[model samples]
Target: MIELRNVSKRFADLVVLDGVDFSVRKGETVALLGPSGVGKSVLLKHINGLIHPDKGEVWVDGQNLTRLKRKELARLRSRIGYVFQYGALFDSMTVEDNIKLGITDEASAADETYSRKRALQCLELVNLDPVVAEKYPAELSGGMKKRVGIARAIAGQPTYLLWDEPTSGLDPVNADIIDSLVEKLDDELGVTSVVVTHDVRGAFRVADRIAMLMDGRIRAMGSPAELRASTDAAVQEFLERDLTIPVHH
Candidate 1:
């Protein structure tokens, strides 16, 4: 499980996360939902020890990330998988090579045949043709590239998966496809997932529970129906995308 206790962050003059608390349980899928600048991505970073909080703690599986040194952080990070918004793949490398990057040595490099076969199997999980394994990222469509990225993220079979805006740049159909795939990963593989998304509709469809952030704090955390029926104006405004009503600064 992942836990954040009174975590806070600031960017020089601006405070991004202020005394925020949220957690992702084992086998649970939690969506961080909020406006674009509410530090949703920052919260995701804390889970993987990408960024330490200014104060308080981020604990994953009983390990307090802030207490860990750099080397320990690396070990903690290796257990987690991440899929970024842009599906950052090496344009020069083939899809197979990209996924192979995640594979640990001795397992992946046991022999040339073993490595290639494992990489291909990971690609198959994302529903990509084995033929495309040799293709470069530039050759794949946006959705395919995203799938390949997901394939790569799971190549090492991480216990925790963090998705940073999975459906950001895809069409509705493709976005839904990705959403289904995420749900499949959790259900089939039992991988714990924490997805940070500004897309409310997408979040509702994919998330087991949603945590809404505003003013650098978690304003609400509940199931989709619970969040929709919330009495808080902030929650209502965020779900409704109320641009006309100005929130106090």
Candidate 2:
């Protein structure tokens, strides 16, 4: 389980997360939904210990992230896979090599044969053709690059997956593909996942539960149906503006 209790953070005079409380159950997917710049990404970072909170605790698998040592944190991080907002693929590396870099274990990463197999396996998991392995990032389309990013993230076979705007820069059709991929992954891998996205449609389709962040706090959170029926003014306004009349799966 991943839990954040009254977590708070700030940069100089700007407050990002203020007394935020969040949690993700094991083997479940949760979507952190909010408008851009509402600290959605910041909250995601807290899960992986990329950013430490100023107050409170971040617990993952019963271990406190903020209290862990550097090496301990590194060890814990290997169990978590983080997919960045942008497809942060290395331009100079082949798709196979890029995915190989995600092999967090030193011994496995050094074994050339295993790395190659794992890379191909991850590509297949992301619905990519094996032929794409030899190609560089420049050769693939935006959606393919995003898939490659996810492939790299899952190369290590992490216990938890944290996605930051996985479908951010795609057309509706491609975005739908990624959303479906998310669903497929959940059923196939059963890894705990936290998807940070502003897209309500995609979130509703992929997440088992949705948490809306507003004013540096979780304003509302529940299943898609529960959020849709929310009476909160802010929640209603956001859905009204960001979504069409009826939200369908």
Candidate 3:
């Protein structure tokens, strides 16, 4: 459902992505793995047209993101939900209102009754209580805020979900919680998902396939078991570093 062909992006002298080619199939969850300062997040933005690449093309659900008109891009984005790195909740709005903003369907967003019900349902789907919807972001714990962010992302009933560092900044316990939630949601919602994260354990636990980005290119990619059995130096180095296994080479 998503494809990136020869995509390249650079900021002045710093090249983030170089001839990157990536794809995620329908109903499959793919994790983009890379170290800090790589272009994992930048690549995610390209799928939804949030950031345009300097070269190459990005296709999502059959539409070329680079060629889409502004209105058309917006329409396409409505079917895809994005969960930002740090929740990015509006502090001024209640949790329910924050999630309500995710409702892109004009009629549903306009219907106060439907929005309220949808927000509550989304919160439940994220394992949050309905009472939390009445609270503000400031009132939530870090993990709770992340769950709320997820609730907001799914509030629109999107066909695709893009998560940018969903487990970042959380404690190990919270990170595991988020990982399990990602797995559960993928099974329940059956939405095509692309998760951008540096956490190898979480990626292994949640993704159907993992793609490692290094030196502005996809260095290695495969299922968790396949990656573990890989002999590539760069791939082995990364796996050993994150998994704490000894690297012979």
Per residue, candidate 2 scores C-alpha lDDT tens digits across 5-39 of 99999989989999999999999999999999999
What TM-score does candidate 1 reach?
0.92
lDDT of each: 0.86, 0.93, 0.93
Q: Write the per-residue lDDT of candidate 1 for residues 189-225, one digit (tens) a residue.
A: 8988999998787788778899999999999999877
**Candidate 3 per-residue C-alpha lDDT over 116-152 given as tens digits, one digit per residue, 9 for 90 to 100:** 9999999999889999999999999989999999999
Query: Hey, what RMSD does candidate 1 come out at?
Result: 4.5
How many residue pairs clash in model 1?
0
Q: Which stretches of model 3 miss by more than 4 angstroms?
A: 245-249
**Which consecutive 10 residues in model 1 have the weakest lDDT in total?**
240-249
Q: Which stretches of candidate 2 lie over 4 Å from their true place?
A: none
* Candidate 1: regions farther than 4 A off: 109-111, 241-249
RMSD of each: 4.5, 1.2, 2.7
Number of backbone collisions per candidate: 0, 0, 0
In terms of lDDT, which candidate is stronger, 1 or 2?
2
In order of appearance, the predictions have TM-scores of 0.92, 0.96, 0.96
**Worst window of 10 by summed lDDT in candidate 3:** 240-249
Question: Please, what's the RMSD in Å of model 3?
Answer: 2.7
